[model samples]
Target: MDIANSALRLAERRGAAGKAPPLESSKAQVELANARIEARTADAALEAARRELGLLWGNAQPDFESVDGKLDALPQRGSLDELSAALGDAPLMQGGRLAVALGRALLEVEKSTRYPDITLSAGVARDNEAGRNMAQLGVSIPLPLPTKRKTPIANWRRA
Candidate 1:
C-alpha cells in the first residue's frame, strides 16, 4: 500500500515538473500497475489470514465464501464504577489481584535480600625481631541512603 502511494506521488511530482509527455504517461501507467499489484497482494494476505484463523480453530480447510461481520462495530463500554463493581466480585479478577499482590510481595523480598555496596578489610603485621606487632581493621559503607517516595497529586490544592 505504501509503495503504491509513493509511486503515485512520484508520478504526480514528475508531471508537475513539466516532464515530457511520454514520460508522464509512462509514470501514470507505472503507478496504476503498482496500485493493482498492491490491491491483489492485500487481498491475498487477508485471505491467507482468514484461512490461518480457520486452521487454528481445527478447520482442515476454510470453505467460507466471505467473512460477514462489521469491523467498525465497537463493543459497548460500561461506566468505571460499574466495571469496578463487576470486577470486585469476579473470581478471575480476584485471582489476578491476588497474583499481583503476591508478585509485589516477592519483589519486596527480593529487594530486601540485596546487600548494600560495602567493604570490610582486616590485616595484621608482625615484626618478630623488633618485637612489634600491628593490626588494622577497616570498614567502608555507601552514603546518601536510597529513598523512594510516592505521593498522589490528585488531592493536592493551592492555598
Candidate 2:
C-alpha cells in the first residue's frame, strides 16, 4: 500500500512538472486503489480470524489490535526421507500411536483378569487373658469365572 501510494505521489509530481505522461499518473492511481482494496480485504480476513480464535477461548469479542509475525518468510525445504520421518512426530500420527498403545494396554489388563489374584495376610494378636501373643497366617485366591473373562476379551478382539 505504501509503495503504491509513493508511486502515485511521484507520478502526480512528475505530471505536474510535465516530465511524465498523464497515462503514468492514471496507472499509478489504479494501482493505489487496488492496493487499498487488497489491504482492506486482508484486514477483514485477519479480524474474522481473530474473532474465531477468541471464540475458541470462550470470548465473544476479541480485544487485541494486531498480531506480530513475518508472513513473507518461507519454511526450509526438506528431503522426502526427512519429511517422512517428521510425519511420525506430527500430532495426528502421535494421536494414532497413543490410541494403539492405549488399546494394547487395555487388552493386556483384560487378559490379566483371566488369572485370579492371590492375597496373603499375616498378623500377631495379643491375648490379654492368656498373656501370650498368637500368630495367624491366611491366604486367599479368588476363582476366575469364565463368563467374566470371555466378554471383554471378545470385545477387544472385535475392536
Candidate 3:
C-alpha cells in the first residue's frame, strides 16, 4: 500500500507538465504489484479455510461483518509490554527514521543554497598571422547575501 501511494505520487508529479515518464515502466510496476497482491490474497484465503491452517500461519484477514465484534473483545489503552511485543517488527519506526533522515537532508540542501556555487571559465585564442596569443579566465559566483535569508526563514515558518 505504501509503495502504491509513492508510485501514485510519482505519477502525479510527472504528469504535472501534461506528460509523464515512459508509460511502459509505470504500467509494468503497477501491474506487477497488482499481480503480487492478488497472489497473496488467494494464498491467504486458501490458508484461512482450514482450522489448523489458520493457527499455523496466523493470517489475520479480517471479516468485515465481524470487525466491530472482534474489536470489542479488547480493552483500550492497556498493556504496553504486550503492545510493544506485538509491534516488535514495526515498519512505522522505519518510516519515522526515514522522515528524520529526509528532514536532515533537506536542511543540508537548504544550507547548500545558502553558500552559492562557483563556476570557472577560461578561453585561449591565437591569431598566428598577427603574432598575438591571448588567454582569459573568468569566475562566476552567485551573490547569496542579496537574498538576505528572510524569505527562506518565512518559508520555513509557514511550513
Candidate 4:
C-alpha cells in the first residue's frame, strides 16, 4: 500500500538522519552491565558444568590451560538501542512483571471476598397422598461480621 511505502520511506529517512529518540543513558548502562554480568555468569556456569562432568570421569585438566574464548570481556553491541528492546522483552523480566500483576489481582480478590459466598436454594415437593405440590425458595449466606482479617493480611504480606 502507498501508506506502507511512505512509512517505510520515513523510517529510512529517520534512520539515515540519525534522529531516533534518545534512550535513557543511565538505564541503558545498567541494562548493558547486567547483560554482560549475566553473560559472564552463564559462561562460568557452563565451564563449571563441563568441569563437573570431567570430574565425574576423573578427566584431568588441560596441562597448558589455554582457553579459546576470553572470559575478560565481551565486545559491545553497535546499538545498545537494539538490545534495549530485547532485554525488556526477556522471559525473566516478563515473568516478574506477570508475577507482580498476579499478586495485585489476588490481593484485590482477597479484599473483595472478606466475607463468605452468598447462596440461594429452591425446592419443590409433591405429596401423593395429599395430591398437592409445594414450592419453596430460600437463600443463605454465611457472615463473618467479626472479621478475622487474615485473608487481607496474608495477601498484603505476599504482595
Candidate 5:
C-alpha cells in the first residue's frame, strides 16, 4: 500500500510538472485505489489474526489499535539447513517424536501382554482324621486365542 501511494504521489507530482502522460497518471490513480482496497483487506486479515491470537491467550477482546513492529528491521532468515537442524530440537517436533516413541512402547507392552500366561500353584492339605498331609503342585499355560483379537492390534498380538 505504501509503495502504491508513493507511486501515485510521484505520478501526481510529475503530472503537475507536465512531465507525465495523461493515461499514465490515470492508471496510477486507479492503481492507488486498488492498493487502498488491498490495504483494507490486509488490515481486516490482521485484525482477525489478532483476534485468533487473543483467543489462544484466553482473551475475549483484542483492543490494540495497531501492531508495533518494523518488518524490514527483522533479522535475515537462516538457511534451510539451519532451520532443519533447529527443527530436530524444536518443541513441536520433539513432541511428535515423543508421541511416536510412546506409541511404540505401548505397542511393545501390548505385544508382551499377548504372550502366553504361565501360572504355578502349590498347596498342602491336612487331614487330621487320616493323620496325614498331602502336597499338590500345578502349572497352567494359556495358548493365544485368535478369535478374541481385533483389527490392527490383532496383527501385533500375532507378531
Candidate 6:
C-alpha cells in the first residue's frame, strides 16, 4: 500500500509537470485501489489464522490484538548431535520405545502361561460332638493343556 501510494503521488506530480501522460496517473490510481483490496484480503486472512490458532488453544473468541513474531526471520537450526539427542525424548520416539517394552512384557507373560501353577492347601477342623481335632494338608499342580498360544502373540504383533 505504501509503495502504491508513493507511486500514485509520483505519477500525479509528473502529470502536473507535463512530464508524464494522464494515463500514468490513471494507472497509478488503479494500482493503489488494487493494493488496498489486497491489503484488506491479507487482513482477513490474518484474522482467520489468529482465530484458528485461538481455537487450538481452546478459545472461541481471542482477546489479543495481534501475534508477535518476525515473519521474514529464519529459525535457528540445531546441530546433528543435538537433534539426535532430542529425538530420543520426542513423543513419537518415546511411544515407540514404550510399545516395544509392552510387547516384551506381554511376551514374558505369555511364556509364563505355558507352565503349570501349583496350589498348596492346609486346614484344621474342630468337632465339638466328636471332641476331636483334625488336620489336613494337600498339594495340587495344574496340568497345562496343549493349545495354540501363538494366536494372541500374532494378534499383538498385528496391532
Where's the lowest-lDDT run of ten residues in candidate 3? Answer: 60-69
Each model's lDDT: 0.74, 0.91, 0.69, 0.70, 0.84, 0.91
lDDT of 4 by residue, 24-49 (tens): 33344455566667778988987777
lDDT of 1 by residue, 27-125 (tens): 767878878887999999988988898998789688886777788998899999999888888999889999979766766665554556688999999
Model 3: residues >4 Å from true position, as ranges?
Answer: 1-88, 127-129, 145-159
Candidate 2 displacement at residue 104 in angstroms: 1.6
Q: Best TM-score goes to which candidate?
A: 6
Q: Residue 158: error of model 5 in Å? A: 13
Candidate 2 vs 3: which has more TM-score: 2
Worst 10 residues of 5 by lDDT: 148-157
Off by over 4 Å in 1: 1-20, 69-159
Two-way lDDT contest, 5 vs 6, winner: 6
Write model 2 residue lDDT over 1-159, tens digit each, in one string: 999999999999999999999999999999999999999999999999999988988998989886777799888989999999999999999999999999899889988877888999999999999999999999999986555344677888787
RMSD of each: 12.4, 12.8, 23.8, 27.0, 12.1, 10.5
**Per-residue alpha-carbon lDDT of model 3 for 19-126, expressed as tens digits?**
776674477478668967987997777555553444555745533322224655766775999788867467887788888798768767776776777999999999
Clashes of each: 0, 0, 0, 0, 0, 0
**Candidate 1 global lDDT:** 0.74
lDDT of 3: 0.69
Candidate 5 TM-score, C-alpha based? 0.49
* Prediction 6 global C-alpha lDDT: 0.91
User: lDDT tens string, model 5, 1-159?
Assistant: 778878888988898999987777788889989988988999899889999988987987987766668887979899999999998999999999999898789888777786787999999999899999999899999886677537556665676
Cand. 4 Cα-lDDT: 0.70
Tell me the TM-score of each prediction against the true structure: 0.31, 0.47, 0.40, 0.46, 0.49, 0.52
* lDDT minimum window of 10 residues, candidate 1: 150-159
